[model samples]
Target: MRILYFAWLRERIGISSEEVETAAPTPAALVEELRAREPRYAAAFADTKAVRVAVDQEMRGWDADLAGAREVAFFPPMTGG
Candidate 1:
């Protein structure tokens, strides 16, 4: 799957995007896999409640299934002015 990071998450992870091969079933599972990869990923995903997820460009809950998903994006929660 292709993963994208935005805002502070990208800054912390030190990358805008990457392609990953995972057997994860859901967004939450994917997050756990990424978090175990390294310190950067661990730190970026430290507080999952503050993170937002999108699967194949559509916003979804952490439990969103990732089966056949081609892309996933992560970012901090947004606030409007």
Candidate 2:
């Protein structure tokens, strides 16, 4: 799976994206897997409430299924100025 991090998430994780091999069934599960990887990932995902997710470029909730997802993006909510 391809994971993309944006905004502060990328800054905290120290990477823009990565190709991961995971058997996670949901975005929430994927988060737990990533959080277990390292301190950076743990920190980045520490507060999921501040983040939003997208599966295959479509916005999705944390519990959303990831069965056929090829790409997942994590980013903070946008603000209109």
Candidate 3:
């Protein structure tokens, strides 16, 4: 799977994107796997509530399945003034 990070997520992880191999069934599971990879990933995914996810470029909840997803993006929720 191709994982993309944005804004502070990218800054924290120290990369814009990465390819991962996993058997995770859901987005939250995938996050747990990534977080186990290193401290940087752990920091980036520290607070699930503060993060938003997109699977295959479409917004989804943490419980959303990642089956057949080619891209998964993590970013902070947008704020409007």
Best by TM-score: 2
What TM-score goes with each of the models?
0.97, 0.98, 0.96
lDDT of each: 0.96, 0.97, 0.94
Point out the higher-scoring one by TM-score: 1 or 3.
1
Model 2 ranges off by over 4 Å: none
lDDT of 2 by residue, 1-81 (tens): 999999999999999999999999999999999999999999999999999999999999999999989999999999998
1-81 per-residue lDDT for model 1 (tens digits): 899999999999999999999999999999999999999999999999999999999999999989999999999999999
What clash count goes with each model? 0, 0, 0
Better of 2 and 3 by lDDT: 2
Residue 70 accuracy (lDDT) in model 3: 92
Off by over 4 Å in 1: none
Candidate 3 lDDT at 32 equals 97
Ranking by TM-score: 2, 1, 3
* TM-score of candidate 1 on Cα atoms, chains taken together: 0.97
In candidate 3, which residue ranges exceed 4 Å CA deviation? Answer: none
